[model samples]
Target: MSNSTSETVSFFILGAYLNIGYLRYLYFMITAMLYIVIVVANTSLIVVICVNRSLHEPMYLFLCSLFVNELYGSTGLFPFLLVQILSDIHTVSAPLCFLQIFCLYTYGGVEFSNLAVMSYDRYLAICCPLQYNTRMTSHKALIFIILVWLYCFVKFLIPLSLNIRLTLCGNTINGLYCSNYLVVKLACSDTQVNNIYGVFATALSILVTVLPILFSYMRILRVCFSGSKQTRQKAVSTCTPHLVSLLNFSFGCSFEILQSRFDMSGVPCVLRIILSLYFLIIQPLMNPVMYGLQMSKLRNICKHVLCYKLLAGGRNTVTESCEI
Candidate 1:
């Protein structure tokens, strides 16, 4: 890369061609298993939502959208990495690399946009209860969903385009996937504009996603504070998932920025692995855990449906015995 031998190194997911050691292979297998479990569980949750007609409410709809985004995002990283690690082929072409970045951004970005949309929905639902039905109509929900994807589509391209023709120079990324920081580090050209634009991108993340969630909670807090103890507890229960997820997301990303600013770029690989693990596993894990466990309605409905399925199976068995 120093122009001595004109050799260029490419950064691809390191899962492929791992170090020649048993421990490294063990790490790869561990991640692979975790990735597979996440994909299956999240995919099943999404399927359950789609198949169950009772979960047609706006709130669940938002959660389903989020789960869908997670499905896409998870597919981009883990499955691909698992394959690379197992097969020992880490090389990815430029187009495939860009595609990976695009897919990840689209998947994750849409989820962020959808969170804001969900927050606004909550605002309207709680703030103007009487008008909730009319305001969040099927037509309106459809329009809003359309807008979320559009906004995400545009927002994703902002960072991606900022790196236009900006080569990664001599470094293949260290991480398992294509990322803004991973890709940008290799550019030999003046990257100030991209960095400044990155600040704007970070601001967009905070302004559009983080701030709205805060605003939603702030409003929820005011409402809950004025209500009875039961009402306060209910509001807290309803908002806890959002709060947890927001903290996970905000803290992870903000740490990245703070660390980078301090010239502390050599963050341990394990930390990065933890951050990645949170999204790949923890976020998906939270969906069913919070919604099914915390919400009385979801729990009740699940119980009823499960009971029905078991009863039906029993009845069918009885009929078969009688026929025999």
Candidate 2:
């Protein structure tokens, strides 16, 4: 592969987009609606947590971080996707593609790190109820959130840098969006450094994020079993949403990884596309709904806020009607 050949490639052709004919508009509308829902749901929750003084705890702070990340991740993908879906050509400029890759990878890393920290917060609250305030202060939780974002942003840069420098023999990607793995596969140059570093980064990420989650949950479970019924009920009530969210995200990510790395030609194209996008789509949409409804404090506050707004609007309408 000539260096000139790689240098000549200025854009990438996404090969997975199907010829849905007129139904493209339908798909675009559905995708647009989904994006809107995700944005509204996550943003509403973030605002709920931020404005309510009573909700300013370690867990709520973590939830706020999670909601913000959902917005970040969805914004990275949805706008780009809407444009592509409407266009006749399914091509993306090199710079834009790389930017998307950076946004998405960092989003994933931060999400995992946030969830891990949230698990640890839960552990402190449940396992060491007396010392939770001393152990996990709001200031400390803020620091952890800042560190999680910074660490993920910095950690993913290595791969993104390596990826951008690659001499690609091809400019075709077999997916709906820019993927680091697919981009690396197109490289004509030796990718031993990239491959080795990828493995190392992935392992390190799992060790850091997964270990804390496992340890925290194990302690929580131990306490639940040995303690009174009230202890068990408390653990179930608080931990259920977090556990559900973690499992849902894990499954979605697993589907994405499997779709990306393995040959899935036997699978239907529509199903394959859905499975590939499951992590990005489902997690953003699900997190807010799960957390908002499951947590009693959040649910009550949301209801109160919503009812107040509705009543205020009704009062204004009645006043205007009387004046007319």
Candidate 3:
């Protein structure tokens, strides 16, 4: 196709239930339920954190931020995906596709940045317990959250804006979601600038986010080794949830980056689709579940909320019966 034709054409999302055959309806039901579960789980955690006065420390605030990010990321992808699953055509307009890429990519960057902030919070609390309160004040924690989001926004927006000007070689996006890397692949022009920007952004993102977590954990590990049994147990209780979250997010992100940057034509189409959606689908669901089960404070708050909700539900039933 001609460059002009390709440039104006909208993208066909070639990965939508590509190998699912007649199970598209079943797939839609399963994903829709999964989406609801994600929504409820993340929302519940966010609400619990917000409502509890005792949970107002930096660590809980960071957990709240992480939950919010999960919800933000999932919302950007799942609604459009559900619609696409039911629709006969799996196409996205060029503008809409680019918009999804921008939103979802921003989500990815912010996720890491938030994790890094959480790691820093843990480091202060564990390794430097005496100064943790004064250093990790509420105001400072809020500033870090704001900066993490702002940095992610400007970082992802630059390349996405640059991408909008590229003349495309094709209109087919080979994956389920709109990936910045995959979109760049379709460009017909010399994408050297875009490629460079992507590399710089990726490297910087890892440095600013993942490296800190690794470093903070290293220090925490050292302290745990030297400290008494009580200290080690305290460290394990507090740090394990964050570590679990980081590992889960890292795994999902690795698969996503790998699939986006590399040629995965040899991979099975079904498996490729699963890998592509892993981060988008799994992280939101997993983070809250992990934290809920692992963190004592959050778990208690959740139990209390569940009990309150159940009591209210039962009261409504009894009141209805009395009126009848």
Candidate 4:
């Protein structure tokens, strides 16, 4: 393919999709259900947090932001996957592909940034209980949330811009989605600039997000060790969910990075597909369920809401029966 060919390339062929025949419909149904669950679960938690004045603390606000990101990321991927799964031709238009890349990439960036901020919030609430109120107010928490999102979206635009200018030698992507790394690999032109910038951006993102998490946890750990039993219990209650979420997301991302960057030909196609999607699929589903169950206040509120709705429906049914 000539340099001019890249400009003319309008769409990309996703080569990794296996011919599962009629089973594709089964996959579609399953994916559709999972998307529904993710949306409802995350949205419910967000609504609960927003509506309940008692839960309007900085930590809950951060949780709300995290849930919103889950919704954003799941929406980006699940719809595209549903369409591609049922279609015989697994191709995505160049423009749509790039857009998906932007959404997914920014989603991941915001997720890490949100988690880091949440860790810092936990640190403040635990280590500096008295100053926590003055230090991390709801207004400041909102500002942090806004900044995390804005920073990720703006920061990722650099790479997206770089990606769009590449002279592609190929149009086939090996995975279910358009990956920046995979797309860059198809470029016939020198990707030295892209590669260099990629390394820089990735390193910067990791450092910016990871360093705060480490520092926050270190201080939290210190407090837990020297403080009273009540202090340790408080730290454990709050930090456990965050720690689980962080580790789960990090594990999925690690596998995705490995699959994208290295040769995964030895892995089974079925297993590879599952692993590639693990982060996107699992994190959104897991976060709300884990948080809803683990956080006593949120859990109690959710139960109250559900019970009220159920009772109201039952009363409406009884009233209709009497009228009839």
Candidate 5:
């Protein structure tokens, strides 16, 4: 075996610090709080959809899937990030590095795929309301969701396989987390194959996930333009959240991809860190809030649940006092 291949080297993640010392506690507390908010927001939406039988329909089911994807993406990043922010040294073992790469990539892929599927769901509902119920059955929706996740997971594995074999001489990852391109760039040997596969995978994933969203929205737009006033209002109400989510996610992904590929040496480290961590930090918190506040049914259900919890807490407090 090659010496570089066999030799163990610790990877220092130099992206977390801002050169001014003592911000670790500040960063740690802020990140921890953000993580908690993400967990709470996404979980609340998921639980609301799952518990409410009325939300068992295809649209809500797809929404539940999206919330789950947000949670997956956040968990892949925030916990490790919280720890790194608190620790004096930011380092990661090779295996854990690779695992994070897989997770974050999968999270990104599944996110786009879920949004695309949700777009399709919206298209069917608005464009073909009569056929929607028959075509978008629970079984079929489940199948589509499974296929989106499976396809993304399997496709990402190929690039990961190529990455794992390269002999890396360097151990410094430039960004906050284990980015696929950054990891591949650290190789001691030529990474032409990895680079090629990485581009191909990125293009294919974008094509498959984004194209559908665009197509679905275009069709919906056409239908809405031709339909009645009520139809237009309904379409706007239903589609607004999905469109907002798409825009947010796309913006974050674009910044991260650009950060990974381009020369960012001139950019401020603090700005770079924000761009790199944008999707991980913002999108998870954004999606649930967007949907919860915009979608009337979901908002009502969440309010109802919160009120019930408050009343239950009050009853428990009274019972405890009586027992005392």
Candidate 6:
């Protein structure tokens, strides 16, 4: 009975964040379903990569990294969202808010690095066949992933650790979750230093990810188009999805950054949801399906799972027939 009353209060409080009018309840329920699917799909991909030796290449290696990031990333987000959806007076402590911003930036920056690295790997394999193996050696791969994580860690902690320590004036966080910018807006102290440094860090991350990517694709396009027949087809199949993901994330992210100049505070709640989904909803969900598990190797692994299940079923059927 107490649980029921608590749930009712939660629902009421969470409703304040949604203005769906006649369909508010439906919209909230659908969002919940989307979160569940994201968890299942990404987790499935992570498990497959871990248990399957065949997916140990640098590409899948980076993908597995992404899967892990997505896992924790969802944890940092969805639980709060779930609780918010269930109960009202959704408030977070300042330290917790800072932690949320730090995690979000950390994961997001790491993802940028991961995707960029993956893109560069593909570029080398396609454009420079002879040097691909040498270029993307195990040592090199380890160093690269490590550096990406280090870079993101520094970027995330520096801003948040400093900013969150400052006294906060306005305490209300507009978005459902704590975001870096949102927290900065709450600072009782002037946030200009934080904002400047934060923007610098962000620009550095983007440039690090984008410049090499641009060069890689340029060279890749030149090499692929220079050849003909099967090679061209291979290149398109290999790179098209990467291209789609880059466009999706980069476009939204760039727009998001640009909008910050005008104070992202003014942006409507709905638009914020859309932008958040660009990374959380759109990319993570599509990546396992389009990038990771859709590969021929992953497909074969799926076949293996299915075959094992069928064989088990067949044995059960035969045993039952004999008993009969």
TM-score of 4: 0.97
Assess candidate 3 and give its TM-score to the true structure. Answer: 0.93
Ranking by TM-score: 2, 4, 3, 5, 6, 1
lDDT per model vs. reference = 0.68, 0.93, 0.84, 0.94, 0.85, 0.71
Tens digits of per-residue lDDT for model 5 on 1-324? Answer: 232453455553555455546877887888889989999999988988988999888888888888898888888898988777777777888788888899999998888898999999999999999999898998888888899899989998998888888777767777778888887776777888887886788699769987898899899999888999999999999999888888988999899989998998999988988898898778898888998999888899899999999999999999999999
Candidate 2 residues 1-324, lDDT tens each? 233366656899999998889998999999999999999999999999999999998899999999999999999999999999999999999999999999999999998999999999999999999999999999999999999999999999998999988889888899999999999988889999999998899899989899999999999999999999999999999999999889988898899899999999999999999998898999999999999999999999999999999999999999999999
TM-score of each: 0.82, 0.98, 0.93, 0.97, 0.93, 0.84
Clashes of 2: 0
For residues 1-324, could you state the per-residue lDDT of candidate 1 as single tens digits? 342222344444443144545565786788777767767666656666677877777777777777777777777777667656656456676667877888876876786778777777777766667898888875677677777778888877877887756754554555556665666776777888888887888787788877887788788778887877876776677767766665665565555445333444476756755654455456655665666676676667667767999999999999999999
Clashing residue pairs, candidate 3?
Answer: none
Would you list the clashing residue pairs of candidate 4?
Answer: none
Regions of candidate 6 where Cα sits further than 4 Å from its true position? 1-16, 19-29, 255-272, 292-294, 313-324
Model 4 lDDT tens row, 1-324: 333465657899999998999999899999999999999999999999989899998889999999999999999999999999999999999999999999999999999999999999999999999999999999999999999999999999998999898878789899999898899888888888888988898799879899999999999999999999999999999999999999999999999999999999999988899889999999999999999999999999999999999999999999999999
Residue 1 lDDT in candidate 5: 21
TM-score of candidate 2 against the unseen true structure: 0.98
Cα error of candidate 4 at position 184, Å: 0.4
In model 2, state the lDDT of residue 150: 94
RMSD of each: 3.5, 1.6, 2.0, 1.5, 2.5, 6.2
lDDT of 3 by residue, 230-300 (tens): 98999999888778777877788888888888888898877877888887888888888988898888898
- Rank candidates, lDDT, best first: 4, 2, 5, 3, 6, 1
